[model samples]
Target chain A: MARPDQIRFRRSTLGEDVYEALKGLVLEHSLSPGDRINIDALAREFAVSPTPIREALARLEADGLVRKRPLVGYTVSPLLTRAEFDAMFEMRSLLECTSARWAAERADAAHREAVSAEAATTVAPQEDDPDGWHAAFTALDARFHDLVAEASGNGLLRDGIDRLHAHLHLHRRYFPYAQASATVEEHRRIAAAIQAADPDGAEAAMREHLARARERHLAAFD
Target chain B: MARPDQIRFRRSTLGEDVYEALKGLVLEHSLSPGDRINIDALAREFAVSPTPIREALARLEADGLVRKRPLVGYTVSPLLTRAEFDAMFEMRSLLECTSARWAAERADAAHREAVSAEAATTVAPQEDDPDGWHAAFTALDARFHDLVAEASGNGLLRDGIDRLHAHLHLHRRYFPYAQASATVEEHRRIAAAIQAADPDGAEAAMREHLARARERHLAAFD
Candidate 1:
């Protein structure tokens, strides 16, 4: 059996790898917002043909990380404006609250266990191990939300929630651990409600968590 | 200024035409559900190179009209099953209700006119002119929903609603004019609520319309 790290040996196509690399560049602002992407230049830098780069750019455009013009090539999409951020949250609230309500009623034992485990997990103080803690925190947080969405048993709703969260992640400013405790506690409350099969409670808790999350991120717009 | 028909005379790049043509083929079931799409064959058929076909397939894949695999080629997605139809209606309810509420509060004069114009217009009769009347009904129905979404002024929500409706269209069975009156009257109720700037009324009316629409379409599953 492959070890945890050895899972990387699983063959992914070149296109998938290229897509990830290009997405990283955009998310980390290496390819800064509104920067035009030159297909030939990227091809030279990646030491491959422009085909994969073009494919990746098209996928990224679908993901809302970039935009393409008719005759002109692709450009990194500008950061989410303050107004867009509110719209994003409103969309999230509509989907996730419904997901939580459904998940409470529908989640089977396996999904219930998964959601609980993810919610109970937490990051150590980032002062000692900033990068490791930050990655763990983000992944756990994302997984908890995704698990709830999955447990809702609605593919359309789950896909919408997942994509909106990814879009929200792109707008996040880099930061460490300050609100980690509050966020984790909120997840626990939501998870508890779902596990208890309290549909209204789960929905309300999710709504509260999203409201708080919006408050936490609102400063990034400034 | 160009006439409505003359708008098509404006030049579009090869890729745009290819994309639209391919989308039409899928929606009309000319390319039936689960049919594999061959780039080379499609290029030959369309009298274009394989490059444009590949680009169009990728765009169609993004639109949920087709699926692509790593080594294998693209295939049209299967029709929505009964379960998926339920999920689709659920998602539409969540997004469109929010849109209608916001549109009620936010719609400007132009948007109000557009929504009213679409709702007020109707197909005379399909007994003599089935195809033209069917086309008119579909376009007007779609335009009304889109106008409300646009009037909401929430790009993310609007785009989600638009994409879902297109996805729904792809699954539709060809029929003519039976439910047109009921659907149009429901649309009128929703429009009246929005026109009156009553957010709660608009939301409730949209929700009621969606529930009835779902009931109307449920027999297709059987």
Candidate 2:
């Protein structure tokens, strides 16, 4: 077994690795939004041919992190505008709030335990530990939301939420942790609602959380 | 201007053509559920190399119409089970109901006219015109639903609902239209709700319609 810090590629799929690497660059803002991606240039930079890069780009395009034009090739997706951010949260309020409600109604003991465990373990990223905090926060945020979506017991709905969350993360990278403590508290309340099997409470809590989150992101522009 | 019946491929993108052709096969039941898709055979059938075929499969996989395995290759996605169908409808109820509500609140006069026109013009498929009916009904059904989603003004949510409806259509091909009149009537009621700007009414109408649709599909299994 590899150690926790050890990097392992069990399958060593080049295309997948390239996809991750490219996604990292995007998330880290090295490959900035709306930047045109030159396939041949990326191939040369990665010291491989164009095939893997193209495959990676295709997957990224499907993920909504990249866009492809008919004759113009691919470019990094543009950052979300204020209106888009509002639209995103409205959609999230509809989907994730419903997810929370369903989780309250449908989550089994195992699901409750899993969500509670995550809520207990996750900590707010500190100001000084920017890189480490970013990584920790991203993982925790994804897990917390993903578990709620999974507990909804609707695979298709869960998938849609997951995709939207992925695109949201791209915009999220621009903002710092202004309301981390509030976020943690909100997650606890959401989890508690679900654990208590209060469907309406869970839905309301989730909506409140997302509304606050939207405010936090909106404040970034101001 | 080209006629509606005319075939037009201005760009002649082979991958897109293959994707549409393959999707048509799946919709028409020429490519049945759970059937393994041989890439080489598809390449031969299309008289093209493996690249475009692989691309088409990748897109289809993203669309949830097809599945890909590591060593086993591609296959038509298996039929949705009873539980999945129920779950799918539950998710759709959440999404499309929200869409209907938003369409009521947000849709402009043009959107209202488009939906009203579809509801008014679309007739139940005749007994002797199964194929023509299928094609016409499919187009009108998709357009009606899509117009509502578009009116929601949330591209992400609209895309999610669109994808789910696509998968639902795959299952819908198997069941004969037992209540096409009910469907048309339901559509009219939904349209009327939106046109009247009654958000709650629209949402309720959509949910009721989906519930009835679910019952119809469930009856198919018996």
Candidate 3:
């Protein structure tokens, strides 16, 4: 059981708390895709009434995170098929490439330097420690792209791009074993292109990197 | 008053009902940007408990459609200023141009014919009636771009584009008087480019059209 203070500090509503708990289960694969969620059990475990649980489930349904049957209630949304995964990467590449291009044109000296430093932190070889290296690279990669979105000076675009990235991250954890070195090299090239203020080069580099990543992920499934 | 059937059909949970109702109010501009939303009165009007209203408000807060103060409660989000609006259009121009390029590459004969028909409907002079012309042109314009997104065969891209279009439309109602005729002509050219399957031409046409639209919208603010 969570401490009372911890729960209070989270400042989440009952519905939101329920949603996050359920989403965590899905993300960790403890609640596998297409598995029906037992709402009654969840309500009992959470020490909350069923109404908030139902509301949370409906909200998740709206988000495409869960699906509901007419009489059977909700289940976790399925894992992305290979084609859907590719489509997701393609969308990400398009938006992120544009974001990087805009950032190259708009980023201030401080922002560019910070991004470069973050990228540098991920460049050292960690061949013996794939998981640690992957975690570091993922954090740096997200920060770099987020910085680009902020530099683009479009809140709406940034919000949309961020949401898509979050949704994609759920599926990304499964492919941690695929070509970490090449992934790091691609990130280095993307950072270098942005630092050079080469918008077209940055766009091309990011697109190629995402395309390669998608291929690698799909290859693992096969 | 809405029909009894409509009301009955809507009776799922109080939170869902309040959410749909508030979204309608915002989309219709009945609750204009920056207008204060009184939660107590809304709860009373809906004849539901305050908990559901609070939950619905929280969701709206997450969606960026409403602003919540620490103690002052909620209000409708404000309209974007001229600069913010221009930035949004810049992003839209990029995404839409890419969509047009993809559409030109992928659109079949049937899709091309449908877009061409919509474009034709939009091009004839309705110059004397700016409001009616704007409405007609806007609907046709939405169909043209939506078709392009659909033809791209990327569901993620289509969903992102649709959401951006919706958020952008909230401010579009303010731009009714700005070179609406020239805008229609530009759409006609873009449609022709798509019909001819000219990828570069379609992209260029969309870029020019969006640039002009941005200028006109900003000029109106000045």
Candidate 4:
């Protein structure tokens, strides 16, 4: 094991290091939903004192990534219900549609080209490669949405949408590979609309995509 | 001052207690935007050790309520710029509109009555009393929105919207109160639409209300 002080000193910032580490744990499902986290153990594991760990936990708690029982300590927040899943997607549709509309209004040739390139990257020949497709598509999807947010020129909207996107990742692993391909196709359509600079078309395409995604996710629950 | 051990023993869930305390500081403007907070000082002030304070700061930082400088320590996040403010309101308009739509779809007689009564409370004789109206209206606004979220039956959406609402209060205080009566009137219209269970009407009314609110807020920056 690495020396405690060595690890602590090596970290650029105690809070950030702890945050990245814990967020990884949640994403990987090493810490499943509703799992209680022991602060002392986490502190020792990270080779820091309890302070940074506590700080990291507090951040995660507020993000709804974790839940705190007044005296019992922190637990990973539970998986979203069908209703929650629908509502979240409804929100995503609204934001993403708005983003697409703005992107159409604001995207330059370079931004349009960049989004197209991202979409093309997702269409590899390996038809059954779920992992490769998932990894590639995830980055592309993020880039696509980010490009829209950036083009929208709305920092606060971008920030809020980005945060929602992050929390949505909590359930990403549960999505089947087939569903991901459909998302890739949707991205292509959205990018095309932006490239065409048709704000109404882009908004419609993005909303349709989200509606489809919501239906697929709800089906999985059933 | 409270006993150190007494405070520590009063809450072993350091992260949660710290999050609540720090959140209060941010919302109440006890820690204004860009104001630096020393962890050690916070620890002392809370009558707890550095562990909880550090933890709480981490959480606040994540929520965008506080920001950490590499070596300087944490500070309250600054106010949003005009573009950022516009984006926030645009998104708020979208979400709150959706919330109102959902409320209309699901609101019972009791819920409708509650919303009507809350709106009625804001129609005071002192139309110029921003502070008093703010105090009353803010709580009513919260309850109105909370009820909408509850009606939506999505815990995740409710949580996410509530957090955004809290952060928004940070900037709302700066908005001038010259049009307090107009604001109250807008709320009344929104309440009436919701009471009528007209989802489309409620949504349209909310959009108008938010758009007007955004204009009012933006005018302040001029």
Candidate 5:
């Protein structure tokens, strides 16, 4: 039999495990947007109590991935409207531009190395593996922005950008990975500017990249 | 005795009630930073189970107020380091300036009215009621910023600013209200610029106000 301490440790991590599981369910569309989450059913499925399930849902709610109403329990947050999309892009322009500039000015050697590594590894994802390619590109894109945010040398700034990116990931999942080649080149420009410690160049490059990304995403609606 | 539906309805709001209670404790410093939050203790204190307490802590963690650890449990997050403070101010400069510009451009009659009302209501808080004065000033300051953020016509932007402000409130509670007169004048400038729909003027005014605020806050460290 497991020791008492061992059992306690396992239980302690149960909430975190449930949080990750629910997040996966939401992102993978196992729990579609606007789908009401049956808390008791989830607890039974996961073989845990309702406490952990409720805790997990609360964290998800804060992520803007889920919604909770009085007496309504939890539901997956609905997809962003076009206006929300525009607002997100506008926010990105303000934040990412500032992040790029700070990354250029404050990035240490490790941060520069991270930027270089991301640039070197990026390539044109294959069309045959659409699902796999999408997942891979999404992760790579996230890493690139994450590295820049970290390099900004501002914890709150990094966290704000991280949360914004987390919200964007949902909308991004539905969009095509078109303009991969163009984005790779754009990344190179951003990387170059950061490496050279050219804050203005870094800011401008990020702005241009986001402007293009907005154009590409807007095409989805049309 | 309450009916079955009424019982269910009461149970539904338990988590929200617990959340507010816990938040008050943290904001009031009844639960000081680094203090361990015993789940069972809270459950017993509130005369409820641990489920709602866990949910409330999860949300607080997302707010960057409470923190969770593996094997251990929840604790109030530590005070912000100088670096963290600088990071927050930098983020505010980017976000608030953009928000002010947008408020100037996009604010309808209702938003303009909110700004005017808040500005008109301002007065130099009396010294004897420092606690009351502080609370009043904080609320008015929050309303001024919130109005600008709402007038930005971007939900995501407003939410981002709101969360950052929530985090800053912890640090700000320690600072004095010495700059109230200067701040009132600054608010006037920002409100006038927004009312006039001068985006550039509003942006510049906000940037200047934040710069001064930053200077005032930095004095706390000296």
Candidate 6:
């Protein structure tokens, strides 16, 4: 489960940013769920001491990205359970729908333009480069949602959605090209509603998209 | 600014409970906003080594309850800004209103009974024992809201609300006896609606209560 570039820390002389690098590994599933972290091995990987790795792990433990038992050290958190997945989608719908409504009503010119630009970018997976395509596709998808949240003009709502642990790894394995295309269409609908300054329409569109996304994610379990 | 009981770690023989004790200090405002944590002082207070104290601070930083800087160690997070307070209230209204509606629609007999019990509770702050009374009053208020959220059957919604970093300290100092009573009456209205299985009534009551609460908290900034 190890790769040479698994966790490419910037490796500042002062240990400036090991935390973000480590967090990226966990979020991207390079560390893999339920894997016990090997601090010494990671230290060797970066040609640094173990202090920075341990420090990063401590912070990750608090973020619920990792768990620390008395003797077990730390393990990346298990994948989201079915019940957790359902509840999170409920929370997402509640927040994101409101975000869309607010974005439609009050977004500035910049936020509007930015969201539209993000929504308009769409692509299908390449047969020979599926991994590369999936990476670009999901990155764009996350940015689209984040932009809508930013346009909502509510910092708390943005932060709330930001904290929800994203299960992008599930998409890498289970999400098909057809579903990816459908998701882009959903984004375009949401963007159109926002561009029209139609709060009700934006909210309704967001609700529909989230309901469908929930169903799509649930298919992973089946 | 130190209280003998400020940290009050359970002092497990294994040093297992230090993180919780440290988190309590920050949550209760005993550590105070923007106060630089004196790890050595805290270690001495708990009669433990500095290792546990440092460990807990790392976790609190991840929780956004504390901040760390280049040359500086950890400091408790600053109090919420007026904008943050307003945004958080908006989020609270969204989630709590949904929780109330769900409680009305689908709460089992036990959840209904528990919510009714919490809502029926009422009290006024005693002038002679204002601190004592405020403690009991605010605790009950938190419990009442938590019970309704639990009754909603959405663990993610409940968890989102819990992570909002309660500013109960605002209530202790700024909220008065009449306001305390009014808050209880509002709780009763919400509880009664939920008990009666009226989703519209419960949602409306919760929305109204959150609006009033927003106004109450705004008084702190003014």
Greater-lDDT candidate between 1 and 6: 1
- State which candidate, 2 or 5, has the greater DockQ: 5
**What does candidate 3's lDDT look like per residue over B1-222, in tens digits?**
565654445335556678888877776578888889888898898898777777677666656778766456689888877777777787788688888888788888888877677666644446687656555666666776787777767877777677666566557356554466687788788889988899999999989988887777665565
Native contact fraction of candidate 6?
A: 0.65
Off by over 4 Å in 4: A1-11, A123-136, A178-180, B1-18, B123-137, B175-178
lDDT of 5 by residue, A1-222 (tens): 566754444655888899998987787667877789999999999999988888889999988999988776788888778888888888888889999999999999889888977866775578798767766777788889889988988777778777777677556356556678787788889999999999999999999999998887777666
Q: Which stretches of candidate 6 lie over 4 Å from their true place?
A: A1-16, A46-51, A165-172, B1-16, B122-124, B165-172
Which window of ten consecutive residues has the lowest lDDT sum in model 3 chain B?
Answer: B5-14
The residue ranges of model 5 lying beyond 4 angstroms of the native Cα positions read A1-12, A123-128, A172-178, B1-12, B123-126
Q: In model 4 chain B, where is the ten-residue run with the lowest total lDDT?
A: B6-15
Compared with the true structure, all predictions reach lDDT values of 0.84, 0.83, 0.73, 0.75, 0.84, 0.79
TM-score-superior candidate, 3 or 5: 5
| Consecutive 10-residue window with the lowest summed lDDT within model 6 chain A | A165-174
Clashing residue pairs, backbone N/CA/C < 3 A, model 2:
none
Alpha carbon deviation, residue B39, candidate 3 (Å): 4.2
Q: Flag the better candidate by DockQ, 2 or 4.
A: 4
Every candidate's CA RMSD: 3.6, 3.6, 5.3, 5.5, 4.1, 6.5
Instruction: Give the CAPRI class of candidate 2.
Output: acceptable
Q: Model 2 chain B, poorest ten-residue lDDT window?
A: B169-178
**How many Å off is the CA of A81 in candidate 4?**
2.0
State the displacement of the C-alpha of residue B58, model 3, in Å, after optimal TM-score superposition: 5.3
For candidate 5, the TM-score is 0.91
**Candidate 5 chain B weakest lDDT stretch, 10 residues:** B3-12
lDDT of 2 at A206: 94
In the range B1-222, model 6's lDDT, one tens digit per residue, is 777866746344233467788777776667788889887898999988877666677766766678877556778878777666677788888889999999999999899999999888766557898767866886798899999999999987887776663643422246656687788889999999999999999999999999988778677676
Winner by DockQ: 5
Q: Write the per-residue lDDT of candidate 2 for residues B1-222, one digit (tens) a residue.
A: 777885675574777789899988987778988999999999999999887787677678778899877556889998888888887888889889999999999989999878888888766557897877877777777888998898777887788788888788567464447677788899999999999999999999999999988887777676
